[model samples]
Target: MSRIEWERIGRERRRVSRWSGGTTAEIAIHPATSQYAARNFAWRVSTATVEAERTDFTPLDGFSRILMVLENELTLHHEGHGTYRLRPYEQNAFEGGWRTSSEGRATDFNLIYDSRLRARMSVLEVPGEAALVAAVGSLPCEEGEHWIHRIWYTAEGSVEAADAGGNALCRLDAGDALLFAVHRSHGEESWSLRNAASGRAVVIESVVFS
Candidate 1:
């Protein structure tokens, strides 16, 4: 039988920080690698609150990166691609080799994956029942030889996900996340999500294809 392993990340787990660009970043998830020289990792997710008007992103080689604005607005300047403005919930993807810089203060969510793996990230707002269902329905399951892994982060209010028969799977608060794996052998699966708090909830979904 296919099963969903659930986990809840609270504020205490986000205690680790890495300093860069005059700010500290919270490392939410970092997959283990065998050696220090190993450039590739399974995946990594993190968040940072940029208090300064301008911040330089650390150069990451041999990886693909996605950044989403969790609050406020910011403009990203890619070495070759001109400046791109991002508002709340908006995201941009770039090759890790690019020299990227940003200006304006905002809380941001980031996903970085090895170049060999395929990855995608998106932000969904669950303001009503239909929107919540649509977001949950968009999660893809493993098929054939491919495997899919997903990470869900709550950016706004609290949210809860449940299995088809109404079994509570996971509940996430602002800054919390749930990561799970799906395999081809799991067969078809269905899940639903609802805004557990009083208002709308925003979710950031990061998926990896390996």
Candidate 2:
């Protein structure tokens, strides 16, 4: 099994729009033709700029959603679910079907996944000159399963991904992302995410298992 197959999604591919108060830049969507306007995607990832002071979130029934603030602060009020206060890098997962509204001027990262898949999202803060390791192994994999994807988004500063041998695999700057597809039969694999910037680097990491 050839592992470590990855793709670098540059800023150019991020389709951005400024026609609304909540301008969004779509990073990627599964199925290649999943329509955001039609809400028919298996999974989708993107960033949104919340310019309005108070914005009502669209109800997306039959989907699970995760939101993380990338800039400024945010407060989410999900009716029937409690309200959540989120700072930069902080996240809250809620049902997309909730009557949700928010108050904040911020930039945020989001993930929406259908019930057919299980997903997890987290943030990695790497101090200057330091590194964090991402390891995938047999624990999460069952007997010969596939369809696992590990995605990394550079939210702040710069980062470098290296293999166990310390050989550089990829370097990502802010607003850029990398996607890795690994088969469970590969047994195990790991990567060291290093802060290649002068200060610190923040990376949004997500794992989707189907």
User: Once model 2 is optimally superposed onto the true structure by TM-score, how far is the C-alpha of residue 142 displaced, in angstroms?
Assistant: 6.6
Please state the error at residue 177 of candidate 2 in Å. Answer: 0.5
Candidate 2 error regions (>4 Å): 18-20, 137-145
What tens-digit string does per-residue lDDT give for candidate 2 at 1-102?
225677888877999866345789988787568888777887888999999999899878999999999999999999888999999989998888899999
Give the TM-score (vs. native) of candidate 1.
0.84
Which parts of model 1 are misplaced by more than 4 Å?
Answer: 22-40, 128-131, 134-145
Query: Candidate 2 at residue 100, lDDT?
Result: 93
Give the distance in Å from residue 200's predicted Cα in candidate 2 to where it truly belongs.
0.8
Instruction: Estimate TM-scores for all models.
Output: 0.84, 0.90
